[model samples]
Target chain A: MKWLPRILGAAMLAGAAGVGIATALEAPAGDPQVVELLSGLNYVPSQSNIDVVLGEGAVEDLIEIAEDSSIDSDPGLRIRAFRSLGQYDGNPQRATAASALRRAIADYGAESSGTKLLYLRASMLSLAAIDGGNAVSNLVTMLGHPSRDIRAACAQALGITGVAAAIQPLRARDLIEPEEQVRLAIADALFLLGSKG
Target chain B: MSVLAATAAMLSLYLASGLACGGAGAGAPCQSHSECDDSYQCLAQVCSPKCTRNSDCGDGFQCNEAGVCNRVFANLGDPCGSEWDCEIGQSCVLEHGDSNDDQKLESSCQEQGEGGRVGSTCIADDDCRDSLCSLGHCSQLCRITDDCPDGNRCESIPRVLGVDDSAFFAGCIEDTSVLSTTIAMSESSGTLRIPVPSSAESFAIVAEVSDKIHLVGVTRVDSPSDFLLFRESDSFEGFLANPIRYARSKEVSTLIFPSNGVQEIEPGVYDVEIEASLPPFGPGTAVPKVSVHYKLRDSHILDLTFYFLNLEDHPCKESMGIDNLDKSSAKNSDVFQDEYLGEIHNIFGYANIVFPEEPEYVNLKRERPDLDGITDEQDLRDLFRLADNEDGLAIFFVRSLPSDGVQTLGTTIPGPPRTPGGPSSGIVVALDSLCYRSWTTLARITAHSMAGQMGLWNNRDPHGITDPIGDSDSSTGNLMYFGEFGGTELSEGQRRVLSLYPGLR
Candidate 1:
């Protein structure tokens, strides 16, 4: 499971290259099937359909589309890519995604304006999905961040990680956590960790 | 702690007992009043001087009306922390309408000198100057809507004191209005489509079913992409046998395409394809499912009355007496109503239980040792006796119910129960003791009753089969989710399903 993300990422990239050719040969770009496939790259892909597209070797294309500067320019499209990228469980290829998302996170922070909460949130979620040692450590560090959303996102990611090591840190954080919503996130994270164990 | 002790620990708050066997301490342990030395009677197992009058206690202390010597902690207009911090029987209330104080009280203990006027917040009747606390508000008691303040009407809400103890409190609350629309096969409206014109800013859908049938609907959005969003009603035989197609939506006709989108969204096309089908009816099985979609644009309301039934030797009812229950249940109901209002829809109407004299029916489970805690034939028979719903939902609060945990907090008949005579009406009998559980659990159980009444099924994952309607990918955060914990919301599908029932009509 620890190695799952990298393996899946590689498989996704290789399979995506083949799928990109196959899909183009099979149907025109605007086809409903194509639309559905492209919709997977859209901000909120259906969970059930996610596996289907990833299995069809569309993961690589999803990555490419997500990374494209033109698409990244659009908040909706960029967030969608980040979101899809975040769903990658254990793919080494996620390093590229992680870096891209990190930049987005940094850019959003630098701008320090507008309604890029969703973008930052999506990036954070992707970072959680593209699990690496750095992702885990960064998320844990976010537990004390000043932003409520960031703290909440970090708590949520830790829970999704299902890492037992997070339990103690979460419990310790909870003692000092002021916000009710953040406390709820930490409690939920603890429950998930305990349940996983 | 013994199992009994643990149960008691979870039951209620108690002043400390066995206080180091010391003297002078207010609630110190003692076998007799003489052990207190300071003259305190052993009331509620605590040694203290019992008094019939205020003159009995010396300076700095007064004999409370309850004949207990309590410190004269604070007086009206005096700053205090809690009611306990004030003189016994005197309530510490938050001073309202002091706008200059940053909406914060500088802290004061005011005498509950007057009866509760309309709109004042209260916990118990004693807190109200008028001696009436209804629905957590200092209600202006009234017999008719005219008696209430302007824009507020009198409602007959139940004063639930205990499982078997209830009384009616006719108090004024804001009036709830429901805008109803019908979903049926008519000559002009053939092919089964409900036009949710963009104009209706907010609304709720309420549908009803009298038989086993598939209620299907397609949410059409007028976006450039015709994303075919499809959902269907659960079948009657499996986990999907629930009638809830959707919970209340945040907005009118907001369809969440789980495949895409952020937050609840109204479809580009304000059109929905609806289809209702029943199993081939051959012998006495043809009940046309009547569905009314109330587009409660801004008024998302579903009213339900809880009838607390008294039964012989029922553990919950017998243990938690009416007065204690009234406070706890009222507090819980207030939270439940507020939760619904905050997350999904507004449950209108009343939040009281009718406590009728005489046991509705003997709880047969107490007599039959072999019956376990699962709700069986006799249980349903007893429950239906108290279910007096001509229409709309009914929550029959009871004492002992079947338990998989400490006790079964809630149980609902998914559809009409099958009997020798045939299937009749069903009831959602929740345990009277549910008031003791966390507010989250109480809310979940109450939501369960509404789901049952609306014909929504439980999320039957432990039972093996996952009903798509009941257990959807969007089940998380949904009120109908399979857990007793966590935040809850109404899914678009759930809202649509709930709208099929004439919940308000």
Candidate 2:
């Protein structure tokens, strides 16, 4: 199926060669979806694309999957694509948000590498805490990471999470940990989690 | 009947929680007066004002002008008369300067699905003690120090996994909050059968129940007749009459019924997937507990008549002319525990292919659940004769030893567990199967069945295998696979026997 990269019919994939690189800029290299998307970038895709490209089942599945971290089982564009979907409203959306975020955090941990990986993991964990209701467990564990940014982020998140349990961890860290600023943040987070441990 | 009246009579609606609630999805709205899942508290003793957090309430919810906690959402500014309007995370506070109706909870929305013993997070094993977070279930139990209830002891529950092994239940030998409960499911399909006390609510699901949702809705699409739920009828005996307390479409939301919130039962006939978030509202929930009962059925071998005995000489008389009824040599098999076919008990399989004189007309219909209107003596005889070619046909007689399935019963809990993974399968039998093509086998079987040839489908799980006959046997040694090169590792005699039959064209 390798053809010259053509965007919207004008040969965006013209440079596409064998099992290697892709010069197509509209999408990432080596991704057939990107190549296909490029080919039709010019052609007016019928509204059927709505149902075909982003079918209802796909949307719902994306929603269901995007909310959880385990769904990152598929290690490719599809996983990242689903994680980027939005949420529902009312009590229903409220209910699905919690574990979905927990899953997202878990999935991010498996995907990331190096220093930036910690940043991404921390960001995702923070995002999970906000989406899910007062999650002290995840937030507290996030504090255990080697990265100070992640620990600080988790400490801050733990405060707003509103679980009284978060206070003990923050206080525990304050007494034992040598880092003064981290201890200070823990003390403040304890105050926010609704208990000054 | 009025909704309330209908709900009251079906009294099971009061069955709170998991043992009953079926599947529900996301993004559906609900009036505070109507609720789903007992997790949401019914303030004022009636269904109203669900407060997951203080932020859900507009402005801020806290201890409002009234003592009840109020709730509020973020960024909408302070707009509330009481604190009860706040959400779970928010705390309603009174304005220091203003005394007139300024009661508001200033707090962020609380996190959802956390802060609990089982489903929530815990720093130490003690916090998670009361809950089991194994195998994707989040229920409270005390199996070990790791699975103990908060402040409880961990002891093994007697015969928890099965009769042979002692599964520990971690809890104080003298602990409280550990409740003993039981639930069951229908045995065969068609007529629902279960054994839950109509009154025991707040119990856990027993392991045996499968494909069982809280409420079961059976509708006859073709027939104009309205579907009826009964308990026990002559034609439709033991049907559920108004099986669900209340039934509704998208319009009619919650039904009014005094809910007890718990039920326990052993085994009996009941509805499937009928429990709803609303009391007896029936069917359709966010989390669906659906089970499936897969079966392969056949008909009764009603009449056995000896037609032609090739004792002297017959078509099946190979080269020489003879037949020996005594040397038929067949051994009755029982539960010998074959590694391949699970534990089969009392299996007697008889297959007969009818042969006729000078190409007589022949036909066959798989006789099972439905034999149609022709249930009389003459009709039954006629059907069998056509199937066996008026008089007799080619056939084989086979029987198997009796065997049991699943080593022991599994740990069955109601509702999705807070703890996701746990080991709870009672039936553990070693099986020697083709692992690589298992999925392909399933797909092929599915395709054949869907194409309306289910009667001819071959089950990968075989009857028995002391190792398929070796090099000399049929190549594939697939008795079920009729027209194929002999299965691998079959006996030469077996292959010769297969060669005697015509191959699949």
Cα lDDT, all candidates: 0.42, 0.27
| Each model's DockQ score | 0.01, 0.01
Per-residue alpha-carbon lDDT of candidate 2 for residues B1-505, written as tens digits (9 for 90 to 100): 2222333332333344332333221112234423534433333233323444322222223323332334335432343322233333332222222233222112222222332434343332233322233212233332234323244333322111211112222222223221222222232223222212212221122222122233322221110122332222223222223231222222111111111111112211233222223224533443322221111012112111111111211111231112311112111111111211110100101111111112222112122111111112222222222223211111111000001000101111111111111121111110100111121222222121111111111212121122222232211233322111112121232222221111100
lDDT of 1 by residue, B186-236 (tens): 321113323222222323332233332322222222221233334333433
**Model 1, residue B276: C-alpha shift (Å):** 18
Chain B TM per candidate, please? Answer: 0.35, 0.16
In model 2, which regions exceed 4 Å deviation? A1-97, A104-112, A115-134, A177-197, B1-505
Give the CA lDDT, 0 to 100, for residue B186 in model 2: 30
Instruction: Please give, as one word, the docking class of candidate 1.
Output: incorrect
Candidate with maximal lDDT: 1
What's the alpha carbon RMSD for model 2?
A: 37.4
Query: Where does candidate 1 stray beyond 4 Å?
Result: A1-43, A47-57, A68-72, A90-115, A130-134, A168-172, B1-505
Per-residue CA lDDT of model 2 for A61-136, tens digit only, reads 4444334335222222322323233222233434354555565556554332232233233334334334533566
Which ten residues in a row are the worst by lDDT in model 2 chain B?
Answer: B398-407
TM-score of each: 0.29, 0.19
